[model samples]
Target: IALTDIGVGHDTLMAEVVPGIDFIIGGFDGRGIREAYEHPVTHTVMVRTYGGVSDLGRLLIHYDRDAGVITGYDWSRISLLAEQETPDPLIKEYVEKNIRSFLKRGVDNSGFEN
Candidate 1:
């Protein structure tokens, strides 16, 4: 199966419905999540978009603590790759934008929305 290729267990991935970005987390062998958090190799995670790829569209992000590189999924399209660069702009911009948007709406301080 496609998941086996990526080592993502089908029965595990926990389905979470984020108001802005829908994604799946826990319920896996930990390898998938560990790898994602580790940034060993680039991986794609699916998200539900109202007018993007489809009901569920795959979004890629690269996370590496060593290089401080937080990369978006389309690394191939980048001139400088995450594996080669120290800090990727894609990751930085994503984080900044998301934070700005969240603060604008004044996200609730009472609960862990995530």
Candidate 2:
């Protein structure tokens, strides 16, 4: 969900692109459970938040606000950055670094640029 306009909006976006395998598609699909929602006949999806930049132009990141930190990230950038020979690794690194710094209460994740 694009929770922009908050105190740390960009931080919310950055955590998404952080390198991790925590977001495999089927990961969110509850397994071994015979829930009708999982049936192929269903077109509707069960999710909370949605909409932001991605391959499909706008992507959704399902987040559970009650517990905290991001649980997954869909690498939808690949579709959008198709012509890029080398994606902006710097931005991702900058995000991770800022996250670390912020965790240490020594720095913030904003003011970064190409």
Candidate 3:
């Protein structure tokens, strides 16, 4: 259902892994691939998001149990800006409290290593 496809060029491997699966989500180097590419054996609904300060991806899927298929879907990536108003109190608190600690953990005099 979901995959973390590292690097920008490894996108084709996502489909190649699961040939006929209906939905496949991937993140490969933030190229932001989104589409249902037609395949030889089956059609795939592939979705990916822009990485690193791009936006938040929201996906809504509708399924038909009788037909055993996904009837429809809506995919979107919301841009997060510094000027935007805070929508959720919990998230805002977590960010304000933990973001500094997280960044500090990832840094030193040499900057980010991994």
Error of 2 at 8 (Å): 39
- The residue-level lDDT of candidate 3 at 108 comes to 53
Cand. 3 Cα-lDDT: 0.66
Give the Å error, residue 57, model 1.
34
lDDT (tens digit, per residue) of candidate 1 on 24-114: 3322232323132211122324322222211222346556779876545421112223454577688888978798777777776763453
lDDT of 3 by residue, 1-114 (tens): 555566434545655665556666667576775444434555555677777867677778899999998888888766676566556888888879977886868765466634
Compose the digit string of candidate 2's lDDT tens values, residues 1-114.
222332223332333443332321221112211121211232222121222332332235566799875554333323344364555789878877767656666443473432
Which structure is stronger by lDDT: 1 or 2? 1
* Candidate 2 Cα errors over 4 Å, as ranges: 1-87, 106-114
For each of the candidates, the C-alpha root-mean-square deviation to the true structure, in angstroms, is 17.4, 18.5, 8.1
Candidate 1 residue 19 Cα shift, in angstroms, is 59
Best by TM-score: 3
Selected candidate, larger TM-score, 2 vs 3 = 3
**Candidate 2: 10-residue stretch with minimal lDDT:** 29-38
Native RMSD of candidate 1 (Å): 17.4
> Deviation in angstroms for 24 in model 1?
38
